[model samples]
Target: MIDEQIFLSEQTQDIYPSRYSNSPHMIPRADPVVYGSDFSNAPIHRELIEQYQQQGFLVLDNVFSDDEVLMFQQELNRLSQDDALKQCDEVITEKNSGDVRSVFRIHELSPVFSQLASDFRTMELARFLLGDQVYIHQSRLNYKPGYRGREFYWHSDFETWHVEDGMPRMRALSMSITLTENFYHNGPLMLIPGSHHTFVSCVGETPAEHYRQSLKRQEYGVPDDRSLEQLIDEGGIVSAIGKPGSLIIFDCNVMHGSNGNITPFPRSNVFMVYNAMSNKVAEPFCSQKPRPEYICSRKNIRTL
Candidate 1:
């Protein structure tokens, strides 16, 4: 069966001009997700690169061993339970249940996570895909406690990043390494395959300090049902499910989100955002101020 393409316009902009300040139009993605043409020295094979390019995401199970998963799990427990980190501004609690929802700038918080960020498996793959020396634009630990964790509405990361953080182009990607088994019922991350080809400019005006609420539950910057449906009709949604050591790497503009976990199994993952050093952040396109450093790192670009 052939895959269907919708709204594949001939127009290609130099940059992905996004949905901002009630913008109604959807910009077909012009930027290439995988910039590295020569993968001779890269870890992944040619077929894998094609698969990732065709679909918006790549799922690799057992990317880490049980021992490494255990180490990550222990580190997860420590950081989530740390009195200092729990009280820090970097920590984000669930809106309703008051449970810990996310912890940002975690690579700066713990050496274990920092080490994982620099791990060749994760780092080199990013370098290969981004086609340049990369740095962490952002890193965080996401935990969705069972029964109380809330759903993250469907949206594109680059939409938020570009409008808020001044990310100049769709030249970044996120790699999420699972620290816990992502069961189907545990609110695993979901992506619309092949949906990265378009940029759905959102409808609402971004409020100041939106990150304060967006981390727990994003309200604005979400795609309208019509735009989301159009993309989903062309490329169906798939959950990134796997064992504790699995890795899911996806484009920065891919449409993704997760449901709230009601089952007893809690889901958690370590997320790292890699940006090409040449594509550093600038002034915001829509917002009056850039997001806090923890959410969008403007400095401390590391090569790994």
Candidate 2:
């Protein structure tokens, strides 16, 4: 077994440089849930739930307005340039190096981020997919610049994030919304269909090891390969390409990752991971455990 501390240090090195980059640092805004009580009645919202379950993923085109996407992108860019967020610059994955120069929990940064982190549409969708009692577990903005080679390896989000027996196959869902145009050239998101139903255990590996293996694979390297296309042809995978404002919702257990950007411009997106309140599973035992941070700011929310 990997030593817990060593394992954690590796994972930490794989993600950001230190704990400060991952912990919650933003203040919360007024609760958006208080704005209305009839969220379950939204038609498109209902459709989102059905589509997610049937296909194991759903793409909502133009879910955010172009203006909204631009605004968020501006904030992300501004924050990326700040000294506080840039402290962990050396440790970020190569794929995320450009836009995500520094990593900070969304809720710890600003009220707008906080509101979006706990948006009603998102929370409602989470409840619909996982049940009414759901919690926002992790959230981050993934910044990808054009021409960067740091693409993630094909893997399930749940594989490394949950306890063994107590794992909930469909306990959580993740939402990735593009803040900029995402196309084949810009490393759009990719997913393997029905892989969520397969039980594959992801033993905790150092982030560095994960990065090295991904870099070695030609499928993830430049000049784009046919492997992803073949998967799509075989009905095994799907490419999620969309303009800014589109959202892709998928089961946490689904096998997914992105290719590196080969375009001239950068692509940016924000992600939030929500786990059904009913499912309380611990992360798999790692000799070196990277402590999980709260995505939502509890201090800002007025408990009902």
Candidate 3:
């Protein structure tokens, strides 16, 4: 059940000031938007803010250093091999080969992951997209292994959250930081630009199935073939192919998906979902069982 205190309380606006922007929503995009220790200047931050609002997504290059990426990769690999991780509900594996597909709420379990979630640059950008006091609602590591990675169907994250988790609005966004090269052939994320303007509600006969497992759904709560075809024809899909340390921030309501990885190269990314503290979820509205807090967070503590 959703916490009543969180749902009814008024939101606070105690945001920390940063060199990036005077206001949370005014991030500029510099003439040459390159991410680094000193790339969050006024112009680039403002541009980034505008681009995210207009297009429902923004991709920035070189957000993290190569060494940082290597460190994260090594840690994630260790976690994948850890036998204890198999017992946790947070880990989701491929049905056939048992390869790890995703590990959720990593921040809650690991100190380094928690620090990464609270990273100043990431939190500041998340505040710009969400609000001043944003909460780390969900964090996960997604892995698309070579040759056998699965496909994610076209569905909005907010749709699942709103219906199943009882989130009231679309005041959340996700940051995907690439740990490996997101190549064109390695199941890079595909998005329909400007698709957040419409909410594609879906209904099917099977309600007994779990919602978090998008791949295992017998009947998915996603757009039908005709609707999907029309949406793709009009909006056009974009593949976010980039080197390691690339970052993509996307609106939760955007229609997005990815194909199965057929190439030998593997794709991996760290995904963090930040939610406006004021936009807390209510009681479960559409599902018999609410997913565990590890998958859908109930805490609303401000990250910054």
Candidate 4:
């Protein structure tokens, strides 16, 4: 096993320097259950802080205006059709129809995306969860096209980042803002409410392969049929069904996945990862070097 303490120290010091002196375990998992009814109305309230800290996830409605979301929708559609943009690896295409599957690194690609990253509402909530100076770790727009969108395998993001990107611990969170209505029938994201508390180490050398295999076989890192039986029996899965402009904040270690969109309705959303500057990534464990800054950002500039 790796000397987790020293490894953690090295990770934190990679950029911020001396911010972390102890083991990664020094950061404990949040409580499992918290808050009461009527919490969503005032999510910024301190009481609800525990709600997210405990369940490892929180869903908020109407974070963006409908007009803003429509503008973004139009922008993404336009970009999807641009041949110049299509040539970029950031724009992934579907295997069968050749339609766009996802667009990565949009924080630098669009002004609206950059503005969203620095938005006060997003920044305030991110700071509450990730500390005062959080940086954008990754950003992507997932377009689950009607009837052809693929399934994302069940897995904790932190697992991949930890081993592949050299992140020492789960001091990060993801905020997914919906650009289209996410009905249950449209392959909305599914989460095991408290799964973030447990780390699942399914065998996989790279997340890309794990995802490719998962979409093809439904057997990638997602809990196996047997394991699913136990995890669901314990925590139960929750479908993230919401309208356009709905925003969800989730822990990086949360066990989550979504089904393939076989229905006619398309589901698209933008998700950005906010990583604490104190949790900077160290040297890679599985690769000879770290991924490019576009994928795994190294900039320590505070977005908020």
Worst 10 residues of 1 by lDDT: 5-14
Tens digit of lDDT per residue, candidate 4, span 28-88? 2432222223445433886557768667788889989999899889877877778998888
- CA-RMSD of model 2: 11.4
Model 4 compared with the native: what TM-score? Answer: 0.81
Residue-level lDDT of model 2, residues 156-179, one tens digit each, is 565445422123334777888788
Better of 3 and 4 by lDDT: 3
TM-score of each: 0.93, 0.69, 0.82, 0.81
For model 4, give the 10-residue run with minimal summed lDDT: 16-25
Rank all candidate structures by their lDDT, best first, as comma-separated numbers.
1, 3, 4, 2
Top-down TM-score ranking: 1, 3, 4, 2
Q: Against the unseen true structure, what C-alpha lDDT does each candidate score? A: 0.86, 0.55, 0.72, 0.71
Stronger candidate by TM-score (3 vs 4): 3
Report model 2's TM-score to 2 decimal places: 0.69
Best by TM-score: 1
Model 3 ranges with Cα > 4 A deviation: 1-44, 215-218, 299-304
| True-structure Cα RMSD, model 3 | 9.6
